[model samples]
Target: MTVTDTEVSGRRYTVHNPATGAEIGTVPDCGPDDARAAVDAAAAALPGWAGRTAYERSAVLHRAHGLMLERAGDLARLMTIEQGKPLRAARNEVGYAADFLSWYAEEAKRVYGTLIPSPRSDQRLLALRQPVGVVAAITPWNYPISMITRKVAPAVAAGCTIVLKPAEQTPLCAIEVFRILHDAGLPAGVATLLTTSDPAPVGDVLLDDHRVRKLTFTGSTEIGRALAARAAATMKRVSLELGGHAPFVVFDDADPKHAAKGAALVKFLNAGQACICPNRIYVQRGILEPFLETLVARVAGMRVGDGLADGVAVGPLIDEAALAKMERQVADARAKGAEVLLGGARATGDDLAAGHFFQPTVLTGITRDMDIYHEETFGPIAPVIPFDTEAEVVELANDTRYGLASYVYTRDLDRAVRVAEQLQFGIVGVNDINPTAAAAPFGGVKDSGLGREGGPAGIEEYLDTKLVGISVAR
Candidate 1:
């Protein structure tokens, strides 16, 4: 796993195993030269890659999907080692990532364009969707495999070449994915991968490169805003899936046990580092107490240990900064009088102290003013707030600047649909906690991000429209 680059700087850094906090491998510290080379590689491959028949592109992606499946276990283990997610969760993420590639493979041939009717009988108007050209894809550390797949699959499906800069902390997973694609017969320059410790410099290089026609990113809102502003200089097409403070609303009509389980599933996934993870839980006043109790019991039963361990339910946070941020958020919430229902203390055992570990926390009596209630606490922390009426709760849920994803738990089908329709989010799950799917469109309505990342809408993000009108002699 030692990656060497003679062209770039001779500096090398080690990638750590989060579970053991041990050095697993070393990667080159890529610089602007590497970034420019990646962009140049993508630019060189664009014409041929884009000119390939849709069927050829689909076949290549199918090969990549097969390779991903063949290496699923290895890739999952790498994800666990670097990202600190439970092995099972990492495996599931790899599977989900493969699904995106397979889905977009089929979608490649289905990028259909419509024909508009013309007033003149002899005139025919045809509109076609074409590739936007070379794409610069920047992925986040959380859900590393799937996030890369979400951006790369669609861009490739739309017949665009890509220069991908994966987060340094979780670069191995993307590297493995790129290796799989390379083994599956992708041209060298069609999909180039680069790893860098410095994101700002690498991002600037990508943004300033005129050959880069589109920029697709998944990260913080601050970074996304800066990238958007820079990309605007060239008027490059941009697709961003940014930060979120998603609310999980449990209505009084919902089954307490079911809602608790669902909430725990969403809140604890990836140590609650996912952008769409439920940061706030708004339970109806009637079922608030029972819901909190059940949720606490569920969280208490979870086993926290190394991700490589078979029965571990939760693992360490990605890094020290993330752990510190979560701790500050918890302290702020407690100072504001929010009740710590169950596990609010960080683990301090000799084995756990070295790595970034936080107890899955549940907070009650949270008001609108509390930082935990309104802000995105990107950790295994859930603040349970009570709401009296549906109108009040929905308003509170939509109050945040982020409109990425939301959850509603209720047996009342009518109420579920009603609440879902009113919630100003891009994706809503009624009973299920998982809102992401290969078949559905996924994106945010507001600051969470612009443009969609799944289904037909995702493909459209990498494509441009062209209209051709022909006049025939009558």
Candidate 2:
């Protein structure tokens, strides 16, 4: 059964499994009217939701988290079917998503106000946080459940009502999430979900509507910029987690095999569909050859098939468009003289012919002229480039307009610290590939996107700070 009975806009659209081109289910092809309704619902519910105490807000989120854990197995299977990640990865995503809700549940009670000493003895000063009102959250297809939870959890925790628009490609997982929230006692209209194929019209309505006080998005940088421009007219607050061309660097002191292994594991996560996946690899010249060899070998051994199939480490790309993009990127690199040291093309046998499957690929002899050198390769291909020194690698890494996240593998404490500091990205991983945690802030600087998500700061994104001053003796 479908998760919702809400009025759908326009026609019904069928969602397909990228791995087998099989029809999974249909969702309402929502449009602007549906978007408006969701916004209206949130606006109507805002006062009551925002008026609730932090403890009350936290209690609902905690219930949702518990419900999520109780349904983890079902949600994970559904996620794997629609989103096309390995079943194990899907299970982990569900758990991580639940953690976000649970973490924000606790954080709600900790949104402390500040008191300040006044310059005048008889005056008083105070700073307090209040909900930013209605929030419009747009999430991507890559990490469906977590992206939604990451944005929704904090907004609700901050006493804000939300209207969520999940990517059309993966609405089932999101629908399930909202169902859990509803079951957890989230008041109707406090949280609403809209599944739509065309988001521009919907986004336009949300951005133009004065009722939406804040907007949070996880998608391409291009879309993020467009949304930001639209939000500008309304002067609404926005938090964007956009595209990333993350760098994975290995210094001479690091173990080439270990660095390569870590890099390989991270690059292949979600079939390299994640925004923070490493797009480029920079290895010190002294260890370049060994690193490349190990990376190629590691990638060579990974299994590529349906996400639900046993032992399948990599799954299909989201759709044919993604597969074509990967094809073009690899073709562009090959034409520019980058050697295809490992799997470099789409998988073909009867077992994989119907699927949007690309083999886990590794390319070396990369140069600045190659497209993969700068563009975000949202596929299972790792482009290995060599650097002569720390200064050169740092310069090369920071040259891109994106500053989302970067990784550095080095045992030298001073070098690691220096490089980490020098890197322009918002989050840096030293000797580790995964830098994310529920307690740490994530987001980027420069063109990668703006504002922050996760951590204590995440709640702030959904809140407005107000200062009060009183003349006690005037």
Question: Distance (Å) between predicted and true CA of 125, model 1?
Answer: 2.1
Q: Which number leads on lDDT?
A: 2
Give the TM-score comparing model 2 with the true structure, all chains together: 0.98
Quantify how close model 2 is to the true structure by its C-alpha RMSD in Å: 1.6
Question: Candidate 1 residues 60-121, lDDT tens each?
Answer: 89999999999999999889989899999999999999998999999999988889999999
User: lDDT of each model, Cα atoms only?
Assistant: 0.87, 0.91
RMSD of each: 1.8, 1.6
* Model 2 misplaced regions, further than 4 Å: 1-4, 8-10
lDDT by residue (tens digit), candidate 2, 1-474: 111356556567889999998999998877887878888788888899888998998999999999999999999999999989999999999999999999999999999889999889998999988899999999999999999999999999999999888999999999999999989888888888888777788788899999899989999999999999999999999999999999999999999999999999999999999988999999999999888888888888899999999999999999999999899989999999988988889998897988899999998888898888889889999988888988999999998999998999999999989999999999999998888988889999998898999999889899889999988976
Q: After superposition, how far is residue 325 of candidate 1 from its true place, in Å?
A: 1.0
Separately for all candidates shown, the number of backbone clashes (residues 3 or more apart, or on different chains) is 0, 0
